[model samples]
Target: MSDNMFEFAFNPGEEVVIKIKAPDLKNKMGGETLQHLMGAKREMLLALRSLLDDAIARTDAADSPAEKTHIDIE
Candidate 1:
C-alpha cells in the first residue's frame, strides 16, 4: 500500500474534516477498485453540506460584482 491521501477543507478557520487514503491504483482487483471508490464517495457525501454552502457563498459573491459592472458592446 502506498502512503497517499486526499484531504479536503470546506471552511476557513476549521480543521480538515475529510481525509481519505488513496486507493492502490497500480494493480487492483475489480472489487478492490470499487471498494476504494465507494470509500471516497462516502467521505464526499459526508462533507456535501459544507461544500455546497461554500460553493453558494462564492458564486453569490462573484455574481454580485458582475451585476454591478456595466459593459457596452457595439
Candidate 2:
C-alpha cells in the first residue's frame, strides 16, 4: 500500500466540523480522493478525526440510551 492511507468521517447538522489528514498528495498520489471526514481542529486537522470518532462512539446505539437529554428555550 502507498503512504496515501487516507480516510475521513463527517457529521452534518446544527454544527459543522471538517477534519482532513492524508499523505502530501503531490508526493505520492499526485492528487487525492476524499472519503468521509470528521471534526475540525483549526490548529491540527489530523487530530480532529479521532476526536469526533470517539465522541460518536460514546453515543453508539449498542450503548444504553438510558441517559439522554432534551432542552427547550422559552
Candidate 3:
C-alpha cells in the first residue's frame, strides 16, 4: 500500500554488524502505527526462531551423507 518498506543488512567481520531501517510512522502510517507493527514483528520473529531451531535439530539428528548446505525460505 505504502512505498515505505523495511530494510536490513548484516555485515560479517570479527564481529557481525546488523542494521535495520526504522519505520517512518509519522510519514507512513500517520500516528501510533509503529507500536502495532512492532508487536506483530516481535511475534513473527519469535515464531521464526522456534521454527529454525526445530529444523536445525532435525537436520542434526538425521544420519545422511548428503548434508544441507543452504536453505532458502520465502
Candidate 4:
C-alpha cells in the first residue's frame, strides 16, 4: 500500500485484504445517524408503495387497462 496514488504496483494474482476501522462512526452519534436515516428511507418507500396501491385501486374498473404480471407485452 502506498500513500502516493501515482506510485503503486500490483502482482497479477496477488490477494489483498483491507480493513477499515472508524472509532468515531462506531460512536453514539454516527451509529444513530445511520440507523435513523436508513429507517426513514425504508418508511418513505413503504409509504410510496401504499400510495401507489391506493391510486391503482381507486381507478375506475372500466377505465382500468389490462394488468401484466410477468410476461412481456410486445
lDDT per residue for candidate 2 within 1-74, as digits (tens), equals: 33333344457665553333444434433223322221212335445657768888877856765777899989
For residues 1-74, write the lDDT of model 4, one tens digit per residue.
34321233457799443332323333445667878755765686677689668878787665778887897788
Report, for every candidate in turn, its global Cα lDDT versus the true structure. 0.69, 0.48, 0.63, 0.57
Which of the numbered candidates is closest to the native, going by highest lDDT? 1
In order, what is each prediction's RMSD in angstroms? Answer: 8.7, 12.2, 12.8, 15.6
Worst ten in a row by lDDT for model 2? 31-40
The TM-score measured for candidate 3 stands at 0.44
lDDT score, candidate 2, position 36 = 24
Clashes by residue pair, model 1: none
In model 4, which runs have C-alpha deviations exceeding 4 angstroms?
A: 1-29, 60-74
Model 4, C-alpha of 5: deviation from truth (Å): 32
Model 1 per-residue lDDT tens digits across residues 1-74: 23555665578887666566755554554677777876776787768778879989999898885447778999
What 10-residue stretch in candidate 1 is worst by lDDT? 1-10
- Model 3, span 1-74: residue lDDT tens: 23434344456655433333445556656345767887776886787689779989899888556766897899
Give one clash count per candidate, in the order shown. Answer: 0, 6, 0, 0
